[model samples]
Target chain A: MAVVLEVEGLKKKYGSLEALKGISFKVEEGEIFGLIGPNGAGKTTTLRIIATLLTPSDGKVTFLGFDLKKHPEKFREKISYLPEEAGAYRNMKGIDYLNFMAKFYAKDEAEVREFVERAKRICGLGERLKDKVGTYSKGMTRKLLLARALMTKPALAILDEPTSGLDVINSLEVREMIKGFTREGVSVLLSSHNMLEVEFLSDRVALIDRGEILDSGTPQGLKEKYQASNLEIVFRSAVQ
Target chain B: MKNFSHLLIKEIKELVNKQLVISLVFMLFIFNFIGNVTKSEIKKAMAKQKIAVLDLDKSEISKNIIGALNMANFIIEEKSGEKEQVVKELRSSGLDLLVVIPAGFGQEVSNFRPGEVETYSYLKGISMTGSRKSEIVKALLQTTNEFLSNEYLKKKLPDLDPKLLKAPIKSREFVVVRDRMAEGSTSAVIGSLYAQSFILPVILMMIIMYSSQMVITAIAMEKQNKTLETLLTVPISRTAVVMAKMLAAGIVGLLSAAIYMYGFRNAFSFNTGDIAKAMSGVAPILKQLGLTITTQGYALFGISLFLTILVALSLATILGVLAEDYRTAQSLTVPLVFLVLVPYFVSLFADINTMSLPAKILVLAIPFSHPFFAVQNIMFGHLNMLWLGIVYNFLFVVVMLYWTTKIFSTDRVLTMKLKWGKRKVVL
Candidate 1:
């Protein structure tokens, strides 16, 4: 498979504290890749760098053969990112927000409207289309965000804590949606604290701890390598 | 380009959603109405002063004195009472001035003796009203004395021509410069005041309303929503992003300025007759000032004014990054307003030619200051200074743009975390 995202020697520091230290990884096209770690394990930092939101202290990221540093615009054109706990403009209606997101990609109004309808259907936002986003429940908002990310059918969609704050039903729905991406030959780079969700959706997982990737493989592969029954055991064994 | 257009559309839509459009329209209506009404009131007030005359000697000289006083715009009310009543009336608010003709006033004049007429007003303190009334009384007395001298000359030389005895060289003044022709006319005074009073308040309001909290909130909202990160990753150049934001801000500022000017124009009550002809004469003076402002000059002036507003909004965005919240951003706006107001205050109090060197330098160095000076210079026909002020304004805006871009480009400005106030990052 062709490599969709390539990171080498990625380093980041917040003042005196190092957030990411020389982390490197490659995400293959048409695969759901997961970066699972503890609360402060540089998962978001790595995602942020890959999204071209932050400059690395010392490293390089290449998206589909384009250097992110030198050609961020070109790299960004192929990627969509939903930050962890991202908030929506409360006053804007659901359909309007969807249309706003579509503008980043679609040139014509017809294309924008078509994409907005698709996003609405995918996110189950039909009845709540005209409702203000501020009135949405957490699960509804999460679905809306997921819909926004998927609107343009970007080559690489980066989702940070995609299921966070979601109920069991919405969580299942989001997981199934993420799993559906791989079937369409779309690449995904998702970060999460829920090992089960990561194991179920990610074709391969990178278990990160203390700003470093401690282990990386398919769920069964990591389980066998760590001499464990599941990814939870594997993560526990690797971090310990 | 598509992304830029998208961003611009988003900005305009947001402006509409936020009700800034409604508020701005309302402000324009109120400001215009007030501006026009104040001008009308000033004109009415100027036409309404009352004068009282105390005639001790009811002679031809006293009658002529009353006639001259009445000939003026004043409403003359004659009184036959003690000097004290006239003094009382002058002290009261009803009377603007009182003229007392002495008992020997007519006899002294016939005998070739110097005569004295007393004028009184209760108005005290060094105010424009007091000074104006004193000037009017003095002028009336001087004219009366001249008429008495001509009478005495007629009496002494019965065959002497009274017309020949009149001052050999009498002067009649015509307004040479079109802009200056309004001098001493209600329009001129009102025009200068109109230009001044509205410029500062409206500019300050525009800067604070559109630039301060609006820019801060927009940026902070992006940061909060995480949309900023997604936007940065897009193929659009960072410079383009900043330019788009500045452009958006510039549009808002221009809209606000247009609203203000509309309000002021609606409020202004100048006589339209001969105004165009008068304005034409000032065209050469305007040209010398680097203005070249005909009606077309006003159009160019509008363009420059829009540029200056763009620069101001850009500077506001640069300052806004330092603030963490809407309140902090708003608090910081006070100093910015004060800075803009300094030029207006100086222009108001200081003589244009005798301003302190530092004030002159500061005024010339600031974009906002130049407009105040430019309008005055254009009106007064100081073409060289006007041109200098325009150039200085242009340079100041350019330099500010460079600095704003520099501040935007710095990495620390984007990522530097600011807690409450231990020490702010210097970026």
Candidate 2:
């Protein structure tokens, strides 16, 4: 399989504090690569850099052979970012919000309409899509945002804690949707604090702690290597 | 281009909502309603005034004096009885003025002794009507004195006209603007010009402040809602995003400016109806003295106004970027408001050129102050100053736009937040 994104020595700094300490990773096409860590483990910072939302202090990000630093707009055209605490324009109806996001990526009006229709099916909000987003429940809004993130059929979807605050049912639905998208040949770079969830969803998981990637492999392989029954045991043994 | 329009339309939709439209219409209705009511009241006050006259002598001169008062838009009420009785009655009679011609008043005038007419005026509250009544007393005394002086002159010296004897020397007033001179009352010309130009600084201040506020609020709301991050990552030019926001704010701010100016004109036109007519009368003299702004002058003023608004919007964009939430955005607008207020009051009260060096430089440092001075600078043929202001504003807007786009284009927009009473930094 072809590699869709390559992050080599990704380092980011804010004033004197080092957020990412020269970490390196690569995401292959049609795979879910999860960066798993606890709170304040630099998971969000790594995801943001790959999403082109922030420039790395000293690194190179090659997305589909285009240098992210030199051609951010080109990368932006092909990648979608779903921040952990993302929000839609509240005054806009859900369908309008989807349409607004689609137009930025679609080729023409027909494409925009097709994207909106796809988003409608993915979200499954039904007639409630006609109501303003401000009036929607949390689960409904999360589904709508998820649909937006995937509607454009981006080459790479960068999701930061996609199910961090969802209920069990909503979390299952989001995981199913993400899995369904990955099966269609979309590469995903996701970050999460839940090791079990990452073990369940990601094709390959990288254990990150204190701005460094301690270990990375298939969850089953890491569990076998650590002589443990679960990936959480693998993470604990690797961190120690 | 398409993305810019989409952003512009979405922004405008967010700002110009149903509630704002309804409130603006309601305010217009109220301003017009109050203006019409006060206008009619003023007309009624001008048409009629009531006064009491205690004609003690009951002579021809006293009757003639009462007739004179009657011709001057006053209703005469002749009172009789003791002096104290009439004087006390004046209080309850609801009359503001009373004249008491003492007994033997005609004998004193015939013997060439000065006639003493005791006048009683009731003190009332200091309303427009109450203050105007005191002016009437002065007019009353002038008319009575003129009539008595004419009578004395006609009897003592019958050969000369009283008008010519009263003013042997005539005074003519002329106003000179640069080289041109116009024959008119200097007061009338200055008053008319002041009336015409006084509202401009207010309008400019409002436009700048309103435009900046719209930008700040819109951006802050986006930040509060966390939509700004999603917007920044979208596949549009960062500069286009900044421009679209400022453009939308400009459209809404100018729309509000037009509506507010129309409402203000209607509200004040009723009270200053005569002033408008007088302005029209003085328009010719103003033109002769080169006090009117030309087409070129107006175009320059418009440019300055446009650039000034752009500068304010740019500053507000930076401020909004620094703000963490909606409430912080409102408090952040204080600097922009103060920038506008300083120039507003200065233009309204003092001449900018006559200000002290430090004060003048301070006022001119604020980009918004330029448009406030543009009208006068153009009217007075100070085209160089107006041109310099337009250029300076243009350059200022360019620099601010560049800086604003820089802030929006980078990660600084997300990470650079003003957190009060905290010392943690995150990336």
TM-score per prediction, in order, is 0.76, 0.94
Interface RMSD of 1: 2.4
The regions of model 2 sitting more than 4 angstroms off are: B82-126, B154-168, B270-276, B420-427
**lDDT tens per residue, model 2, B323-347:** 8898888888998898899989988
Return the clash pairs for model 1, or none: A73-B235, B36-B267, B289-B383, B293-B297, B294-B297
Give the DockQ (2 decimals) of all models. Answer: 0.44, 0.75
Best candidate, TM-score-wise? 2
Which 10-residue span in candidate 1 chain B carries the lowest summed lDDT? B174-183
* Candidate 1 TM-score, C-alpha based: 0.76
lDDT of each: 0.72, 0.86
Question: Which candidate comes out best when scored by lDDT?
Answer: 2
Clashing residue pairs in all predictions, respectively, total 5, 0
